[model samples]
Target: MDKQPLLRNLETNQPCQPLSPQLLSMAATAAYPGAPQAEELASAPPAHLFDNVTGYEGTTAGGEERFVPPPLSTAEGAGRHEPHPQGAWSIPSITEETAREAFIEYASSKCCYSAKPAKEMVFRDLKSCNTYRYRLESFTESRSTEWTSEPYKGQFVDSSAYGPAPLPWSIIVEIPQLFQDNIEKVPVPHTSSIKGCHSCMAMGRRACTNCTATGRVKCQFCNGRGYKFDDRCNRCHGIGLQCCIQCNGSGTIPCETCDQSGQLMIYIQLTVKWKNNVLESVADQQSGLSADLYEKMIGQNIFTDEQVRVSPIVTFPEIQINQASRKAIQEHQVQLTRTSLVIQQRQTIEFIPITQVYYEWKGKEYNYFVCGVDNKVHAPDYPAKCCCTILCAVPGDLPMASGGQTVPPANMLDKLAGYESIAADGEERYLPPPVYPAYNAEGGQPQSNQQWSIPSISEDTARQALIQYASEHVTYSSRPAEEMVFKELKPYNMYRYRLQSFTESRSPEWKSEPYVGQVIDSSGFGIPPPPWEVPVDIPKMFEKNKKKVQVPNTASVKGCHKCMAMGKIPCNDCLQTGRVKCRMCDGRGSMLGNDTRCNHCMGNGVESCRSCSGHGQQKCDVCQGRGQLYFYIQLTVKWENNKFEQVIEQQCEFPTQKLSKVTGKELFSDQQFQVYPILGFPDPRINQISQQGIQEHWTQFGKTSRIIQQRHTVEIIPVTEVQFQWKNKEHSYFVYGTENKVYAPEYPGKKCMIL
Candidate 1:
């Protein structure tokens, strides 16, 4: 016997080594300050002394202008244009307090065009006379602004960052860690159900109409069947009677009530509906409508309070007539008539006066100006003027004149002496009415028939149709008659009469024989057999198989051997308890005296069941090991063309004092600003566009100045110094101080210098 060779395999495992301290420190240093440190000195070479190429000296060999430049920075050229001057004082950066004061001052200033109140004249047209009266009104002031100094009002505040100062660096660590631990696990949802069912036609056992829907029928042989019953008949054998031929089996005839169809005709109500309700108040407005009628039809009472008043201006009432009739006209009466009538009406229009007077609402002063009305007149006799004035016309006749000389009477011969008539033949004869010839009774002659001949049917078609028809109708007994007739009636060939046939008999020419087969084989030439075959049976085959499969056991997998090497066996952690705890009663012993579960197997008893984990089944930690956890996010977007529009109107209520209580100084400028009227530069365009200036008043303002000129100047401050001072200090400065320039003085080295 040969000695068996021994084989053994040994395996050793080791863990990865950590990096050295020096290399780790060097990597940490390189990553310090992130991208910012690299960017600052990015274009310069490393600062190590060995990398320097140039020698050190007090100055570069090429001097100041030739020195090389370092890389550009983000802040380099930002304020290149604004340079500080050598001696001027510089403004310090703004502080929050100073900004607040400036903003407060801005908020207190008033607009320049505020209006003031004043007393003004209004004219009214009365029944008999025109009246003029004065009333209070508002007008715009030349300089209406009011201003006060205060603190800043325009600044934005953020509320989210208002907490105590933070150690800004710590946010980088805490935010991500907090979010990662709190993530929620979401579950998967069930999907919609899908299923299908087969379709089939309806069928059932047929019912016998003779017995109606009831299965039993009367026995005809037994008649009323009080006692002695007859045996069921075999073709009525041994029975007294059989089923009637007319009624088909049972004794009763077809129902005379429903005819044969077994259906009845009767009237039935189809549908009913209620009418709409009418309130009593509404019915009162429409007097012809009755609320009681509506209540009866609608089955409910309606309550209403307000009476709606409808205007005749918008809706008119229907017209009424007393009577109407139509009749044949046998006679008529005619008459001529005349009448005189007069009508009068009053007309009014919006009236704007030629001269308008104005006064201050809280002051004694008043002012006046004019805007003329426009009018037109087509009749040359009436003069066109403003409608503000009244025009009265006097009714009087013109004086009848013994004013001019009279002429002589007319002589008839002078009017008619030269007139002559050209045609003396009784007046011109009228032309005869145009004649239209009558239609001829025969219309037109018929055309000759010699043009084209009609086609004739083939002899084969005629004979074939006759043969088919005779075959269908003739019985077997009639065949002999048909054969005799057909043989006698069949068409024959004709030949011209001649005596030469005797020579053919003596020496005959060759002749051909005809085909004898009754059936035709025309398939190759494409004419199909006259009667085609109908397909009868279609065959189908199917095979269905069902089977079960088995998997073979193979090699054993490697277990957690590291735990085994420590002198302690590897525990089955899947059981969730150490020592695989007794698998029955889940490690609890049997109650009373016996093991409630198998003693050798522990509480689980068996193994690997999906539930009970088979020693059987335990919780799977992988799905916690149950299954996978899914994540989902629900998004809701309310869309309208992806855009929404809203129209908003904002309103605010403010305190207002009565005009009567406001003082004159609050309404208009103080008397000190008032002055005597004076002439100012004239606006030629105003004069040119005026209607009166274009017509009668052109010479009053200017002659040669069609005044196409377009500008004018109105000085708010008068010639008096008191008025100028009262208006404002700025106004005073403009009128009294010497002129000064606002720009800075120039210097040699700098581009701009302010003084």
Candidate 2:
């Protein structure tokens, strides 16, 4: 896989020779079969999984390049390949044997250490001292230079940030005004115009059909003769017929119960209106942003009406309850009970606001990150200077030079790489030493002494993940925390980790489970600790004390007894006697039948509260019938973590930068990933304190890299010494190039070397 994108490089700006297959040759025809030869080059190691990417781990004695390509006379007017900074050093094609011979000849005929080759040796031990570094810088102002930031959008319902909130509903608001307003908005026929139409006693008819105009009808019992034989029709009293029962013997019966038209009037009270439910979003009115749906309008009245049903028209997800919300429903006075001003069909909106800041100072550029929500800097307290922090220096297996007196066991070559050459007593000196000089890149500017970087994850976010991991891993606790968020509980969570071991053999044996331990959180327990035990009972006493807080109870009801838990899943049918008016007669006592009160509901028209069985409430079950419970508690359990879920390693390829104008001393710090054993190590204290195998990761990318000017040395051949044996005689000569005076080739080197 191409890891360039994944691999974060230090970008120390060291120039390297490109790998090429250019063969070099130096041989004098068969005349001098002396097998004379020259030229060999050492190539740099390929990119590999080295402990450090910068490769600035060890202090090397050969601090600077020892080769210088003689200035080219390109314009003898002829085009020529640009001279490699160290090209000429491979000159005359000096072979390894020739170099070896030259070295032996130089050592034997010259001074100092012996030239004899080191004794053949085989070393078995391989060690690596890898140091981790972090870069942190602070600025007064800044803007993103080259970054691909992501804006995460979220949505939540909060009481409106502006205007009023919905709450404190009244249970008994006057209905006269509302009644009048509703009448005007939606008018009905006037009661005075609803005159009744009366008719003849015969069912609204103008005349009785049985009697016609006479309004009297012949008695059916006596026929037309008014006689029934023996008793003279005792029906008609002998001579005539009985008066007409239909018209009561009158010519025209009057129906005074109603007008001849028989029209009747009706009345009703309008229960619902537009103001009954209002849904306002940011677009409609200034509001706040939230991650989850929660009650936003606080201290506002929840208008209710007797005529209207009890259920709210709108609802919000119950996540967490703010303290102010609880108090608002409890302490705030009810504004109206006539009708509930329900929130319905809310129009939610969300946006992730990115604060892009820019600034400039002195002649340099940088940025100041003022974070959102948390109001913190992305990288706070970062240093404002270039850093060449030494990760960790380790001397690998290096060859030891034979000390005519005593041979050193260490690899002289490898050891020499981390330090400048120091002259030995008499015959001692740093090995491979051209003895290059150290150049201060940022002159007059203080070099960064510490190593730190931004974390791949924010401390707050990481803390939450760690706490969750620890909760699963630890074997001891009254109740290990779960689904925990930062600052939700009092105090903090800290733990001592143990590396578990399980036997794997013919008979696999169980080894460890979650360890058992008690959380020393004074506030986590339901019972309060004694005054003297306050400090000791708290976990991370010093650190958490500052952030210690009281979390509101999100588990149960608070505020209005009628609504129960604010507007959050509060009880709609709070009364065990949950009841409503009978639907018949429109809750009116009277019905069309017999124009009398309804017998089913005993004329009340309101049935027994079905929800409450006519009672106001059932047992207070959520609160255990107590109506209250502790606000918070730490869940106790034994941590059963058998293995680590995961370990992350992240790096950035480029350093972030920006332009700024504010001034302040930047802060820098590093997060140490040192593990300390509490029950497993021999010396618990020592094992915990010693950072031997710490796997520290510089996860965060620098917000801004400190720009520094480093001093470098370039190679040049002012004069080259050429020696050879010709015609049985040894002779030396010199080749002087172009005065080679103060040449400038935009060379990779910073200083000029006289070769």
Q: Per-prediction TM-score, please?
A: 0.09, 0.16
N/CA/C clash count, model 2: 96
**Per-residue lDDT of model 2, residues 1-755, tens digit only:** 22121112458534322222231112111322332222111111111211221212221211121111112222234432321112111101222233334334433543333433211111111111111111111111101111011111221212123323211121122333322223111111111112222122113333333454354445455554445654556655654445655566664444333333333221111122323222222211111223222222121111221211122212211111122222223221133222223122111112212122232232122332222222222322222323343555333212312211121212221112122232212222212212223322222322222333311223344333333433321121212112222222121111112121111101101111111232223322444322112232223211212112222111121222212322222223532335667767668877754455564675777777565466554443333344222222111111111111111111321111210111112221112112222223322342332221111110110111111111111111122222333334443322222221111112111121212
The whole-model lDDT of each prediction reads 0.20, 0.25
Model 2: residues >4 Å from true position, as ranges? Answer: 1-580, 592-604, 621-755
Off by over 4 Å in 1: 1-584, 592-640, 648-755
- Residue-pair clashes per prediction, in order, are 39, 96
Per-residue lDDT over 540-603 for candidate 1, one digit per residue giving the tens place of the 0 to 100 score: 1111122211111110111112221121221233332223444544545443244233433434
Which TM-score value belongs to model 1?
A: 0.09
